[model samples]
Target: EAGVAQSPRYKIIEKRQSVAFWCNPISGHATLYWYQQILGQGPKLLIQFQNNGVVDDSQLPKDRFSAERLKGVDSTLKIQPAKLEDSAVYLCASTGTSGVHEQYFGPGTRLTVT
Candidate 1:
């Protein structure tokens, strides 16, 4: 099976600006997730989707960050008025119906806010 696909592997932006990242998960996967990984810490789950419906978003920074899974296939994450603290590698991952233990990740989009 093909791996998850993400766009613009790298991006640099000015603080307070807006940026967006895209992801296309593997076919047949029903669950999708977005995560943020800072320089020294493990990836933090930002949001999760079970087919077009959001399963969890409590960890997401609602004030500046938003995400959606359209048609339960492709997903997008956006940050408006970006902050220096938001600079991190935004990762997209997905898991098959079998379970979360088999999640696959994409080559994350590295965002640098300056």
Candidate 2:
């Protein structure tokens, strides 16, 4: 099966600018997640989708970050008016949810804001 795919391994941006990232999860997976991982820290959940429906987005910054999974296959995450503190690796993962936390992650999109 095709693994998850992401783009722009790294990105440099200034505060108050906007940026977006893309992700394509594995096939036949039922759950997809987007996480923000700060340097040397564990990945923090930003949003989660169960199939085509959104399961959770509690940690997502509504003021700037937004995402969508219209077809339940590929997803996109966007951050507008970026902040310096937003510098982190954005990882996309997927799991079938047939068992407990069985998730596969993408390489991630790293963002650096100045």
Candidate 3:
């Protein structure tokens, strides 16, 4: 099976700028997730989607961050008016089904807010 795909492996922006990242998960995977990994810390779950419906987003910074999986396949995450503290790696991951515990992650998009 092919791995999850993400675009623009790196991004650099100034404070209060806007940026977006895209992800294409493995075929047939029903669950998708986004995570933020700050330097020196483990990845933190940002949001999760089951098909086109959001399963969880309690950790997401909704004031400036948003995400969508409109077709249940591809997803996009956007941050508007980004902050310097937002510098981190944004990771996309997917799993086969509700019962599946193993998640395959994409090569994350690294963001640097200057």
Off by over 4 Å in 3: none
lDDT of residue 81 for candidate 1: 87
What TM-score does model 1 achieve against the real structure?
Answer: 0.96
Clashes of each: 0, 0, 0
State the TM-score for model 3.
0.97
lDDT tens digits, residue span 1-114, model 2: 888899878999999999999998998888999999999999999999998899999899899999999998889999999999999999999998576687999999999999
What tens-digit string does per-residue lDDT give for candidate 3 at 1-114? 899999989999999999999999999999999999999999999999999999999999999999999999999999999999999999999998667799999999999999
lDDT of 1 by residue, 1-114 (tens): 899999989999999999999999999898999999999999999999989999999999899999988788999999998999999999999997774577799999999999
Q: After TM-score superposition, what is the CA distance of residue 26 in candidate 2 from its true location, in Å?
A: 0.5
Tell me the TM-score of each prediction against the true structure: 0.96, 0.94, 0.97
Give residue 42's lDDT in candidate 3 (0 to 100): 95
lDDT, each prediction:
0.94, 0.93, 0.97
> Considering every candidate listed, which one attains the maximal TM-score?
3
> What lDDT score is found at residue 39 in candidate 1?
98
